[model samples]
Target: MFYFFFAVAALITGYFVYGKIVESSFGVDTCRATPACRLADGVDYVKMNPKTIYMVQLLNIAGLGPIFGPILGALYGPAALVWIVLGSIFAGAVHDYFSGMMSVRYDGKSIPDAVGHNLGKFAKQFMNVFSVILLLLVGVVFILGPAKLLAVKIGFNLDKNMAVVVWTGIIFAYYFLATILPVDKIIGRLYPLFTACLLIMAFGLSTMLIVDGYTFFPNGVGLANVHPKGLPIWPLMFITIACGAISGFHATQSPMMARCIPDEKCGRPIFYGAMIGEGIIALVWATLGMTFYQTPEALQATLASGGPAAVVDQVATTLMGPIGGFLAIIGVIILPISSGDTAFRAARLIIADFSKVEQKSIAKRLLIAIPLFVIGFIITKTDFNIIWRYFGFANQTLATIVLWASAMYLVRHGKAHWIASVPATFMTAVCATYLCVAPEFPLHMSADYGYPIGIAVAAACFVWFMLAARNTPVEVDAVDSPGVIG
Candidate 1:
């Protein structure tokens, strides 16, 4: 119980301290207008209140990733808490804040543009196609997650072809409509309501956890390796809790809000603050995962009997009774739907941005969106398990790239690059080692070879960055406004 409270306090404290340090280093200024104001298209770049923008950014990134990922990650033991608190604070929030602010600095272009400017043109091209594929995978997974949940809530046997098909159609229809509509009309309006559901669910469950006399982590924190079978803690745990800790996907989504924020000042609260909010939700779910079951082996056995989504239903129903269960159902259902549509929306904008195609016209939007949807829907018909596994490696790989890009932004401007550079290097090592060692990843090298190869590759990346990041005769001018960094 005390440990849970401490975890919450660390997240909040980290926001004020580490989050603010990130904001100051970026030199956020209120006097200047943002691209949302300077480049309003009445479509995606409409100015919104900070609260609404925060809600949109939060829901845009939250999805089923945090909940489902943490449930799976809880299989590792209380070590998940250590990762969630520290990773979210030092790595996740920094990754998210800089990504959002960088978009604002670059006039609300896609991430490829930002990466291109900092890394190189080739990196930009790779990121553009890579991000589109990643978002497509994310889009399909989110759609399938909710449709299954809807089937469960309706008490339908999902094994029946018609039940799964009908739910999929309903969710896919919503995703299509939400993708084409203006931001203010659909996402900006509906997202706040969805955010409210998520918060209420978190708060209610959190209160029950504390008020109902549940003791978590009774043996206390350690490198005890409490996983049912001794899964190495290094890369598996990091990959499992990707979104809650640090994710490349958030970098993609941050620009969507970057195109809506009216002033630079709100970037701190909206972008950095929203990530802190996500960390809190993740902590709650992780705590629930640790306590709601008896042991790691029992948890594994239960997972074998039923999946992560089923665990959410069982836990909520047991802990909160029927009413809490209903609210949890609503919250869980809203999460993936809100995130799924935006995944497609982000993909549309990325492709359009890559083509330099104007997006104001409904016809142009439809032209790009139709093909992507057809491809995504077809991909959804394959085995979801394989798709999700591949996504984790790709997801973290993108994060490593974004972090290095961020470090580049800091270095080119002659500011302290340590903040971004440190985490960037660490994640690079994590992802590289995971691919080599993790049996699921395509590389699949033995652990003995993987660790040395991981360190060597990461060190090589560091050297490459130091060579490439030499001060250009002219600064890249990452910030567009009069707000200049010395």
Candidate 2:
């Protein structure tokens, strides 16, 4: 029954989200020739087919967060899978795709820039400040936690200091290559190979677990025991599924990819396809987490002792012996690096947009990278679980804001206003309430850190939106002038 629901939800949500991306990009003629839609000559603006773009976007968006978020979500047992899939399709994928298209329509601007244009200068500054702080927080949490887990698997002593040093070097290498090497050459060839490896490793591990007859839920466990917050599951469901639902990372990544899209038609596959890949990855991890650890207590124990990568490694070893363990380690190592690369690139783009720095300049890129590296290093000493929880809260808050902004853009463009606005408004309310009530919930991290940060972000978003509404509207006619996309 659990597996059935999981698989069904995955397929349905995957199709819906992917289809929305395609429809929004091509159906609305957002991809038509315009100055804002033109491709640049360099790494940030190279052209590519939809398929290649899809692969790059998939690899970039699907990261350690999906793996860990589901593991965390499984605290509510198999029931959590339902919300993970549904919310991901409606909230997560929509936010990512539309935000990307909105950025393209606004001259390849990011979420902050869009906010500034449609809202006001204050909204833009608020978003920029929050975004940078949130990015640093996310980057540090992602790099250090996963690096520590990977170190343990690879026999590197797994100390905090060593993990920071090693992952920082890895991030620097990724950025150096991405900035120096041609994106078309690298993403075209290297990404496919990387994706293949990931698929094979993930499939093999999942197949092995299923073959071993690992149970999805532990014996004697019931709904009452699974979620101590009681059976009215809406709030826990909303908070548990972070990136699988909506994330700030997408807001940054979509635009970074949008800048290079040669035509508007390509946006559907790149934006929506990337999200489907991310949803699938989440399903795989959620299934593994549920199957590997029979009980919520057992899963919590494993995570507490060594974090999620350790649990994943243990599951792999249980299924495939030494070879599976090796593959699991490799998979874990790749997850964070792939995400870190995306994170670094997105952070640089956001910085460039906010500061008006010339992205083409190597010196400017280095300047952007340096402070990010330093901040990432400084936060490595913090508790991984705490950081992860805080990031989830911050990300959800950002997602709510972005979704509202995207819906507003759709309305302004005279699209399906109600269709977009209803879901956007509902999700914002649900997520906001969840964050407010989360501190009293049964989840460990939620009560400790997640809910509080969520409340603060929600409050700030509310204020920002109110202020933005007061600003005089930017002339839509001027923005839509001949040869202009923004």
Candidate 3:
């Protein structure tokens, strides 16, 4: 109980304190015209209230990250809570705020263009492909995850395969429509309600935890790792909880909300504050995870038997009872749908930006979206576990790039760069090492070997950054403008 309360309070407090420190460092200029004001096309760049944008940003970034990621990450025990609190405040929220503010400062450009502007033309070129692939992966994963959940909830009266197919088609159709629709029309209109339900679901679960005296961090709840496979804490745990703590996917989603923010001042609450909200949501979910099964061993075994969806079903029904169970199902269903639509939309904009195409008309939007959707739909047929493995690495890798780009932006524009650089350096190592040792990835090396390799890569990056910073003279003005078309 105390653990959950401290985390919640700390997240809220972080926003007022650290959030401002970040805002002041970013040099948020309230007078500067935002994309919504400077490039109002009434389609994607429509200006909305901070309140609405906050809700949209929250729903988009939070998605299954807080719920799914935390549940899986909690398999590591109490240590997971430490990462959720520290990483969210220090790393995750910081990443989101910088990315969103950078977008605002640069006419809400897709993160690729922002990367190019800071890291150089070559980096931008690489990120363009990288960002698109990541977004498509998110789209595919969200589609499959929620579809399966809802299909399971519907029962086995109908053919399970057919149920999955039906749900897939329904989800993809909505993704297509939402992708091409105007910013304020669908996502903006409906996300607030979804956010409401998501929050309620979080609070409801917490209520269950309290009533049940769930030992979130009691003496029995061991903080040490207890994974059945002995998945190393360094990389696997980091990968598992990417969303709640920090995720590169949020960088991609930020521009969607950035295009709607009314002012530079709105950036803090919409970007940073929303991340804090996600952190709180993550804490609640992680706490629920801590208390859900009798022990980490039981949780791991259950996860092995039934997978994450099964875990969700058992907990919702077991702890929350039937009514809470239904609402939990709704919240779970909404998680990916809200994020999935935006993922496809972000993918479209990323492609359009790369090709220098305007998105004011639905026809042009469809022209770009068809190929993307076709690819995403095909990916759904592959193994979910494989896609997720790639996603965890890719998500953090994207974040690493953005963090570097942010550091570069700060340097060029003459602000403190260490804030971004430090995290960037750490995430770079996490990605570099995870690939070398992770079972799903190609290397298949021992976990012991991966750590040294990770350390070397991080050192190499830090040295390279220092050398580059010293050699590369700082620029007076920012490279990217605030009115460039997507």
TM-score of each: 0.96, 0.83, 0.96
User: Model 3 scores what on Cα lDDT?
Assistant: 0.85
* lDDT (Cα) of model 2: 0.65
Q: Whose lDDT is higher: candidate 1's or candidate 2's?
A: 1
Task: Give residue 446's lDDT in candidate 2 (0 to 100).
Answer: 42
- The worst-scoring run of ten residues by lDDT in candidate 3 lies at 477-486
Residue pairs of candidate 1 with colliding backbone atoms:
none
RMSD value for candidate 3: 2.5
Q: Name the top lDDT candidate.
A: 3
lDDT of 2 by residue, 1-486 (tens): 356345656656566665665365324564366323464757576666667777777777666777777777776776656666666666676777777777777777777887565445676778888877777776666566556665565435657667656765675566446643456766556666677767755777777766787665554324343743343455555555677656777787777677777777666567765676676667777777766777677778887887677777787777778876776656656666666666766777788888888766777778887777766677866777677766776777777667766655553454443434445555665566665565544543544355565456556655544454344243444233221112
Better of 2 and 3 by TM-score: 3
Clashes of each: 0, 1, 1
109-224 per-residue lDDT for model 1 (tens digits)? 88877888788778888999999999999999888887777777774654645676788888888889888889899898898888768976788887887787777765566656
lDDT by residue for model 3 over 37-120, one digit each (tens)? 999999899999899999989889877778889989887877888888888877888899988988887788899888887777
lDDT of each: 0.84, 0.65, 0.85
lDDT of 1: 0.84
Colliding residue pairs in candidate 3: 107-482
